[model samples]
Target chain A: MPCKFCSEKPVIQLPNSERKLCKSCFIKYFERKAIRTINKYKLIEENDHVVIAVSGGKDSLSLLHLLKKYCQKRNNKIKLSVLQIDEGIKDYRDISIEDTKKFCKSFGIKLHIASYEKETGKTLDKIKKQHKKTIACSMCGVLRRYLLNKYSRKLKATKLATGHNLDDEAQSIIMNQFRHNIALSARLGPITGVKKDPRFIPRIKPFYFLTEKEVATYAYLHNLISKFNECPYCEESNRFFIRDMLNDVEAKYPGTKHSIVASFIEVLPLLKKKYKNQEINSCRLCKEPTSSEICSACKVKEKIKS
Target chain B: MPKIYLEKEDKILEVKELLVSDILKSLKINPTTVLITKNNELILDDVKLSKEDRISIIPVISGG
Candidate 1:
């Protein structure tokens, strides 16, 4: 099919919609949707310092590329930097970090790298070896998130942007529903965190409405990413199963993923309101914001050390 | 025969002429998780293949 806007050959047929767009038209649509999402949610503001959490993956790199383009196009006085957590997985993370560095350098965006070993005293590979009973992703997620927030706060960033897209959000909503984790579900949205403390940096998803395919296509078109690398520890997590299952259903049902996110967005405010009054505490070891005295990262660290 | 290249697996398969969707189905790959390119160009799922066609399946999903 020709592009919906022009006679050029089409590049992608947007899921859950009848419109197909060619290379140039699709780029415009993809960027426009992100700008609209950012403006609608007030994810970024003037003079705000935005720190992007990048993994050297398509989603993160695409977000980085789009934000740079967005800021330049509008001439917005937004300070942008990049933060990448080195989970210290051999072969997996090292290769991606190199690509991320090149990408950031191309745009002159300052890139900061943190490591699990330096901060937590062990690499993720070592932790996985010692804690055979625990899920690697869970452990990595906690530590990565902890470090992201910790460093973003240190950078004095007003917003932390992630490459989270519609598929990620849909999988998260379903995962939360499956586990009956309403409190965690409350934190799922385009812009995350319920009551932000000075220590906690609010997270935003600029690609909230786009699908993984669309993001991948955009990244490919712009040559923003080097390769598609799946984290070595990812396949063992609950998310991997849910992602495959969701993809299976989506193939058959077409718009299933979009519907999940759309419905979740409608109910997200109610979910957030229900849990807004929850208490936040500082971890005795690290003094980071958490629901309990000790944070999840600290808990994982103790597990590894024990 | 049509040839299918799986980028993630770094493997290739020789298959019968079929629609892109059916080829993915035979390989047990969810169409949602991949993009198909025909003769070095992107194509939609409904596109049919000929014996001379060379298709590449590029996986898009990356677990974060």
Candidate 2:
């Protein structure tokens, strides 16, 4: 097969790496795309440190790997760090953190792991008990995001990067729209970070244009990603079902992921215009950007206690 | 359309006794990862969805 990144002739697809690009343009094009994403979405400014929300998962790992390669290729001076949240999901958290640490160690990125138990004196399993039938990941997610923004700001970083790819974005858009969340779908387009607030550490998804299969295939081909499957605690997530359905759609439509991503660009501007009248205020507890008085993270924690 | 917590009208979710996968399928969303909740209850049903319920679906996120 021809190299996926370029149409240069006689390019061979290697079976042992995350990319199907020719060796010549691989680094250059990857860096260009990263830069393009930033420029396209205005994710980060030059000379700003970036903190990656590393999960040690395929998408996140792939994002980190490509970012490093891109940064080095561009000789960008932005400092990088890998931050991991310890949700204390028994065997799962332990293995995921170990893998993240190992990858960061080998790849030479600074790694930070904040345990949920350590921060709040409670683990996710314990927190789940506070709310009956509430999926554990929800509470953990809010905390992780809160911490990421907090720590990112504490570290004086300019932006936070995550590994949300095309499939992920699609699921969110559909879910939000189904529940009359047009504003949420409005915020679904590609970007390096959120534009609403500065204290919130704008988040960017460089892989917004990529698909889950491409990430997995890249991980599988390159021996890059961790061997673990999805976290066991995520069984309650609607994304799993959405994923299977999208895969079936892709099998029939071939390029659905790209189409969905493309659609976001078209819809995002209009959604923003429509929701421009909505009021946003800072979270009272954390002083971070939020529409609510107390951010969801703090509220969830308070719920856990009360 | 129940009393769902609307996160500024963006991250809408259906919190029912329905399976996470079923909701995703119904919504035509490709699942990456998400957090589900309903009225402070931890729902485990994958196929059952009740009406007049408050549900939340947060996108899969990871950070520290």
Name the best candidate (by TM-score). 1
Error of 1 at B20 (Å): 1.8
List interface RMSDs for the candidates, in order: 1.5, 14.6
How do the residues A268-306 of candidate 2 rate in per-residue lDDT, one tens digit apiece?
777787876666688897677677788888787777775
Each candidate: RMSD: 1.3, 13.5
Which runs in model 1 stand beyond 4 Å of their true positions? Answer: none
For model 2, residues B1-64, the per-residue Cα lDDT tens digits are 4434433235555444245566655665443333334653323224245576666543333222
Among all candidates shown, the one with the greatest lDDT? 1
lDDT of 2 at A264: 73
Clashes of 2: 18
Question: Which pairs of residues collide in model 1?
Answer: none
lDDT of 1 by residue, A1-306 (tens): 789999798989998888999999999899889999999999999898999999999999999999998888768699999999999999999998899888899899999998999998888888888877788888888898999999999999999999999999999999989999989999889899888778889999999999999998898788764555677778788998999899889988999999999999999899889999999999999899999989998888888886
